[model samples]
Target: MKTIYALLGASLLSACSVPLIQPNATQAVASHYGTSAPQGGAALDVNWWSRMGDAQLTQLLALARTNSPDLRSAAASVMAARAQSGQTGANLYPSLTGSASATISDSPTTPRSDSNTALVDSKWELDIFGKVQNAAKADTARAGAEELAYAGSYVSLAAEVADGYVGYRACRLAQAEYQNALASQQDTVTATGSLVDAGLSASADLSLARANVANAEISVTNQRADCKVAAQSLARIVGVSQSEIDAVISKGGGLPKTKPFQVASVPADMLRQRPDVLEAEKRFAAALLDMKVAEAQLFPSLTLNGSITASDPRSWSFGPALSLPILDGGASRAGVRLANANALTAAESYRAATLTAVSEVEGALTRLAAARSNLASAQSLVANYQAYFDTVDRDWKVGAASLLDREEARRQLQSARITRISQSEAVLVQWIALYKAIGGGWVAPKVVISKDLAPKKIEG
Candidate 1:
């Protein structure tokens, strides 16, 4: 009918008048991160720990990449998202289905007759309002998000390994200090006991010395236990058994001297490079496409349907099926509103994620700076205490000082060394934090928008 043709023409014109999803959705990122960052570095390396030149760390990171359950799950998620995107994309095209039936009938005076009927049904929606295309675009956006999420997971795993290893090595350093203190206390206890035997010292003094020895022993035991716990945690991260972890710890030799890394100059520079930021952006894009898809539902849909039957006399039917949804209890409008709300939420989330990334980098830089200062102070104190201990030893040799004075000086020196060791680990952990916040040099992949779903004029 001319009326039907005119209506179709009008629908096509209106549906093609505007794109369902604007191109700005994907690029609608925050202009800048609301904070500052350090400067003076090239882009971070993908294998960031390699810069530390620690062979053991590199090996452990490789092991984690191969065996981390979290990474495996993230990888699986990427695959699922990829498949879903592909499936949604396939829906935008026409499809044909083939079916066949066999039937037999018998009359009272005739033999049974049999025939086979085969039918082919072909159907496809024209997508005049970009409904299917927008849906596919949304799925593709989700796929991109999943891919970036995988990269984020990779960066996080490396940070976890670094955290565990740093703790383990720091524990070892503390344990060694505790052992030295324990030995020194034992010597004090022995010498004090001898003084008591010679009537030069009271039994109470010997008792106090022995008490110090006991306390030192307890500290040494606790420190060793803590080291073991840290080592076991590192082993779990490396996907190995505790004994294997012990081996790695042995291979570590001792607490490492970590190299400080400079952060990106601007917050946006780092946030844009971060995989989580990209993931959030993709999610926002997907949400915007979802809103477009929902709004597209408010328009009429044109479908082409065709069928053919295989028989003694073949038959076929082909026609256009128009679906004009006049009213469905305002569900379409509600759906569009819900989708818009979700898009708004996703946009906010993207902004928040970017801000959080900036905070992480800034916080780590601040902590690292403080740790460096504290370590410098501790090193200075250690040197000064060692000098004092040397003077005390010389005085004690000439009978100008008691053994207790020399012991006190030695304890001060060891305490400073212990403090330096702890600060060293803090600095290393901060570097790891910064590395993770900036996505550890992961190159984010380009977002793959479905070509079929991209905004285009409807071909009516």
Candidate 2:
């Protein structure tokens, strides 16, 4: 009995020490971000879109969360992966099967016999080589990756819906700007006509004024069409009718001003917040486990089988079965090689994902800063141009400025207003991009990952 217990302990120790060949999971990141963006930002709210101060946007996002096909598909994938993990985990336990049969035999010049038999059969893979254990852990890691993928889908959906909403609102605001310009042009035509009647201006001036009015009318027509198209685009994103979008947006104002948010100072911290990055890490870990499982296959496997019977001569039997990979035609060796190559590939992929996440965040910060600066400049230009146009109009009324001067000033002021509105839209769009780049406030759920199962740097 002591000798048997010693052998069992030795087997268990060997099983627990399966060696893994893998790459380091950690990737180097920059200590500080570029782009002149402020450092040390606070944690972002999960419901970041609500800070945009647009109720219509909130409603649209809600609809998208419920109805987006991409999100539904991602959720289904999570469920499938979880089921597969559960199936793999079942291998760690013994399996039992029951069978029963009744037999009757009759022979000429002999006696007849009838018998009933029932038995329970059980089999268990002892996992002395750690093959089953590694495979189960690999599947569990795969399920974790799938869950992160689902969360990533949510982050992407929120950004898309918000981008669509911002686009539609910007279009409408531009349309309104053009409409106001059209009205102002009509007033110019009236004022120029009066001057022509009093012989204070040339008839050619009247022709120019009327032409300006016609051009303004054309702009308004095109802008209205563009706004309608924008609405259709938003409708497609949120899976709603164009009419419904129009109704909801009509209740609100111009482009939404998404409130400010911050990000973690450390690139690693920010990367941790991104689901896609974490998903890649999980996949890499799973690949390393797979390599371990394949390596374990190169060794021997032990399984125990037992059965009991109930009949005239009831009996029971039990024994151990061992499988060796002595002559597998290189199949097992090939599996190990393939798994190692895959682990290397997964490690590189994880590095690539980390780099991408960092680049996205950096680019977003830079673009947002530029957009905000441009918006401020555009606002100032609009204000100065408005004052200049007002003074020109007053000068023309007192006969101190010509009709041409007033018309030129009006054109400059209108152009400035258009620039301001376009910049406003740009600022909002950049904020949305930044929000997505920073993972939209997603945080990794607490999952206890085993160090032995995790990828680690291996010396060649």
Candidate 3:
């Protein structure tokens, strides 16, 4: 017993003697987003899609939140990770098991005999070298990473729904413009036919006018088809019926107008909002803990086991079991090397994710700025063309302009209107991209281990 006590004391001392080889790498990032916008504006809302002020869009996003298969899978992954963490944590505490058995025997030489026994057994591993503790911490960190991944899925789903709605609305707006152009062309064709019948215009002019009307009609038909396809695509994302999607979007709302929100000026501050970046960091932290577990494996392990049996007379036994690495070749050392290499890889991955997060934010900011500028120019172009078309139409009615000139002016006006519509949607799509690039205002959850073994987030 004294020798066992001496071995336990030596094992405890050796636990502290294991050398730690933790290698954590920090990455440098840009200071700003390369924008002049001031930092002080309304903070981004968690439900950023609501800022679009479109009820139909909000409804679609709500449906996607509840019905998206990606989210369901992510939620299941989080549950599995949490369960694994709890399982790992269980090793930190003592375990108890109970068993009962009964036997009856009849022999010619010894008459009849009956025996019954109930046994209680327990085992506790003493984590003197931090192996079990580090393993539990590693699994807990992995659980935290999975939770972040679920949040990432949530942000991605919202972005997808918002982008789909915007696409459908943009297609509808184009269809409307094409229909208006078709009506105008048909009227021109009717006027040209009258002139041809009066022998005042060439029949070739009438033929060209009829052809223009036919082309315009085809344009309208094609635009309508495109709009239907866009709506169907949206329906698939929101997991709703096509008729329901058509009913909601057919209410004739043009492109959604978004309420502007300011982005954080500092890149590091903004990166905190990104779930992928945080998830990568959590994985790195978990890898570091795993390396510690491997390092602890090089030391001795100590476990206490006890058992009690109730039979003809009650009996109990208790003892400490020490397992020293007498000769396992180099498996434990190889494990340590493998874990250290994984930790290094995780650190590099975290750095790469950080760089990607910053680049996405910067790219979104650049595109949004350019879209806003282009939309302004497109609006001016449409206004100027509309004025020219109106002047030409009045002159043609007064016999001061040819029908050909008025028709050309009208075509130019229609083209300008289409450009404006496309640019308008471009601006809105860029806004959605910006929102997603900034993580849609998802805050990193602070995981708090609760009594029920469920991962809970602490309220800020």
lDDT winner: 3
Off by over 4 Å in 1: 1-43, 103-110, 311-313, 392-410, 445-460
Q: Rank all candidate structures by their TM-score, best first, as comma-separated numbers.
A: 3, 1, 2
RMSD of each: 6.5, 7.3, 3.9
Tens digit of per-residue lDDT, candidate 2, span 1-460: 6865565555445434434465766789999787655543345856677766789989988777666677667767776788899999999999999899999999998799998889989999999768899899999999989878877887888898887777777777778888998898899889889988998888998898899889999999999998788778877777767788778887877878657776776788788889999899999999999988987877767899999885533589899986655555667667877898899889988999999999998999898889889999999999999999999999988779887898899889888988988888888888888888888887664322222221111122
* 1-460 per-residue lDDT for model 1 (tens digits): 8977776666545444433323233233344433434444444677558878777777778777766777777777777899999999998999999899998999999999998888988999998889999999999999989878877877898899988888887888899998988887888778767867987766876777777788888989999989888877787776767776666567855655565555656566776788888899989989988988987887888899999886633589999989865546767767877787788789778877877787787677777678768888888988898899889978855657766676678778888888888888887887788788777877754323233221111212
* Candidate 3 lDDT over residue span 381-412, tens digit each: 99999999999999986668887898799889
The C-alpha local distance difference test score for the whole of candidate 3 amounts to: 0.83
Q: Each prediction's Cα lDDT score?
A: 0.76, 0.81, 0.83
TM-score of each: 0.85, 0.83, 0.88
Clashes of each: 0, 0, 0
Model 1 accuracy (lDDT, Cα) = 0.76
Best-to-worst ranking by lDDT? 3, 2, 1
Q: Where does candidate 3 have its weakest 10-residue lDDT segment?
A: 447-456
Which clashing pairs does model 1 show?
Answer: none
